[model samples]
Target chain A: MTHKSLITSLIVSGWLALVLVGGCSIKTRALLFDGVDKEPPPPTTRVRRDLLAEIETLKRDLADAQKALETAKAKQQVKTADAPLPTELAKSWVELSELLPKHRSGQVDWGAALQAGTIRPQAGLDPTVLAYAEFNLDITLDRTKSPTMAARGLSAVKFSHAAHSQWLICDNCHTKGFQINNNGTDNILKHDYCDNCHGTVAFAMANLDTCDRCHLRLP
Target chain B: MPAFSPLLFALLFITTVANAAPEVMGNITYQRQGEQVADGTPAAIFPHWVHRVRYKCYVCHFEIYQMQAGSDKASMQDIIAGKSCGVCHNGKIAWNIKFDTCSRCHRAEE
Candidate 1:
């Protein structure tokens, strides 16, 4: 072979080798790393046949336990659905609302209206109604701040029990938040109270300048 | 030349991509779903570190198994048909699906 031709052949061979090595390295690296997100802890038990069998038995038992728990939760939900509201007034008020729409349009004397027709009781208690009954007690705040609470050196807030009740269970806050008969003296609506769940667990209650999120200036 | 160019391009592309740190196999045992398995077998605990040392990721991932957890449903029939764990353990490569060594994979101690 000519001297120049030999040099060209050598160059070509080197290029080919580089290409092959590069490709192989990438493939190897990806294979070794893919799906590995974090450095997981070491395994406790040996991956032995006997050990594996025991693990399998344990897993089956765990599945049965989980299934039983789900069944119990389902039964509890059914029981709660069937049970009546605590107060006679709450039960009667809900019943009266349903009958008024279907049976009588005008003036509902709750007891008389309820007696006139088969009381198609409300399906459990309406969450909004419950929140309203629980929070909207007749006792007005003596040191009540205006609707625009921000002007009174507090957060400009418009409370939405309806929206809140959608995600949170009643007992999660009910007596815990304020009182069943709230005198409106408690600072439950403040950041210290709200941020317990908001910033930590749920979406943050930050960006105070974006006042429109919680506070709307009533007309 | 046409085929060679594509292969060359692939090689260049792979080499050009930024390299991530090598994966350290810390937690070795991955729990496979026992609920899917019939006969109430416990979920199989796959020792990933053991297999990782032996084979490359592409040998199974997007091939015999998926990259995500709970995605690859390896059945006995599929294994016997030379799929999944069966690919190696199908008697031809490693151990055959014999009755005595059933606990080796199925693992039913209780």
Candidate 2:
């Protein structure tokens, strides 16, 4: 072949070599992206597995608690509706409120009204009456003990503690009308004390004719 | 004829109860003013049945008094200060000493 023709052929061969190298680079890039074509793998955190289990457990516990609460409420409603089996009156094992009569609104609980204090039960000698003296205590104010009562010839004043303590609490008369230490009927003469309830409540006031109510001796 | 035993039992029960005093639990009397026997001041008579009729053992026992009698020797001063019998005898709870005096608790032992 001629020298110039040979040179031209060499140049052509170089261009072909360049085209082949470019094709190889393109093929390598295709191979590098072969594994990445498909969809991404699922998330790693076991969000669905652990959280769903915990939520389910919590929900069941909550439902059980609600059911228990509802059952207790139903039982309480039935208990309130039904009367309990009879027991002894003075039995301490039972709640006294359960046996008490329906009291007035805003009034004190009579069952609780009974304090855990001392009781002068049946202070009087009359066997005919027991329920009356269950809370009753009869007190006598000796005229010899006081000069004012002695001068008036009133041997003693008969105070019916049973009549007062049954319906009224200690606070009703103590400190309000009488002091805690003042045990006599000395406060009875005061219009603010005895008359506050006696004349106002119901019982007729003891006039001059009822002088025996204060001084007469009982057999 | 079938109810004969029950009828007899009830009759006997009522008769027995009726013959006895309503409620009397041999009251205890305490008369000790530090070793020497107390004088003229009557020994205080503790009516056990009177308290037991309305209250349980816990009402007075271990609270105001001890289970063993004379274990708790009470003083008038302590009582007036709201201890022992004074818990209820404060003129409000039950009978006040101002009205009761010595005869209420301090009675001649029978």
Candidate 3:
């Protein structure tokens, strides 16, 4: 073969070898050291990790607050007699009223309980209707901030889940009772959305006595 | 005139040395849970390099840890009882836990 042809052949083989070896080395480097200098994975964020424990504490607090509020409310009729509420009962009543709001705002108020008459099972109402009546849930309205939104509450409500969950499943109201449009249509405080069922079957969703039943912020 | 073989040999030796040099292990940080819930404190930050330098991989890999993130629930109580981290961190082998050196493993400052 000519010297020129021989030199060209050597150059071609060298380039081929370099390309193959370089490509292999690049793959090996990536696979071996993909996370070498990268920061370690962050700790897992726990959601409701102590849910059972919280539930247990809530039960105890609710019982205590119920007892206190009942004692105070019992004296409501005897205005002329003037039976002062027990100090502990009065304190617990105040604490209970503020309880759901504080919990909705993300400050875990395990010691707070619901007012005594607030969660009573109505005797005259049907079992199914009673289920919807007792369904109480604390919902925080701060949607944009996310994980930290609970800490900041622009507006919030204590929804009666005990009243709803027993009679209706998630699908019953998730999309039907309210629009599934998650973009921004989730404010339960709106009169129209709540009035859909409140006035139709349940209590009317007016700014009167029915309003404070769900809206704990009302004076 | 000198042959080009010696120069070629020298270049090959340098290249071989460069390729064969021992790989330096990177520092690894593992965040442990349960520490926060137990005491309302921050999670523990474990520096893997400190332990790996002295012990082999098999020493703790499958036996003590399952090689999965958040799999091992090593509580302070378990460590005190000579399990998981206590295997070595016990008073006999490494730092003794009886000395209240929780900050050694836990982010007590945070």
The TM-score obtained by model 2 is: 0.27
Against the true structure, whose TM-score is highest? 2
lDDT of 2 by residue, A1-219 (tens): 699999999999999977865566545645655653454445555666678899999999999999999999999998854433332233321233344332333221223324432222332223233332235668777875556666666667677766565544454456532443444545455644555444432233435544554466532
Q: Which stretches of candidate 3 lie over 4 Å from their true place?
A: A1-219, B1-38, B108-110
Native contacts present in candidate 1, fraction: 0.00
For residues A86-179, what per-residue lDDT tens digits would candidate 3 score against the true structure? 3223222234334232333333222231232222222221223322233456454333523332434423455555545433444445554345
Per-residue accuracy of model 2 over B1-110 as CA lDDT, tens digit each: 77798999999978874664232223566665764454556667666434533443334544465433446777878888988888877878567877448677775532
**Which candidate number would show the highest lDDT if scored against the true structure?**
2
Per-chain TM-score (chain B), model 1: 0.57
* Candidate 3's DockQ: 0.01
Q: What Cα-based lDDT does every candidate model obtain?
A: 0.48, 0.54, 0.48
Instruction: Give per-model TM-scores.
Output: 0.23, 0.27, 0.23
| Candidate 2 off by > 4 Å | A1-219, B1-26, B34-39
lDDT of 1 by residue, A1-219 (tens): 699999999999999977865676545645656754444455654446668899999999999999999999999998976564332223223342443322122322223323343222231223223211323312223224443343355444565554444333354445443233333434444543444344432334344433444445421
Worst 10 residues of 2 chain A by lDDT: A118-127
> Candidate 1 DockQ category?
incorrect
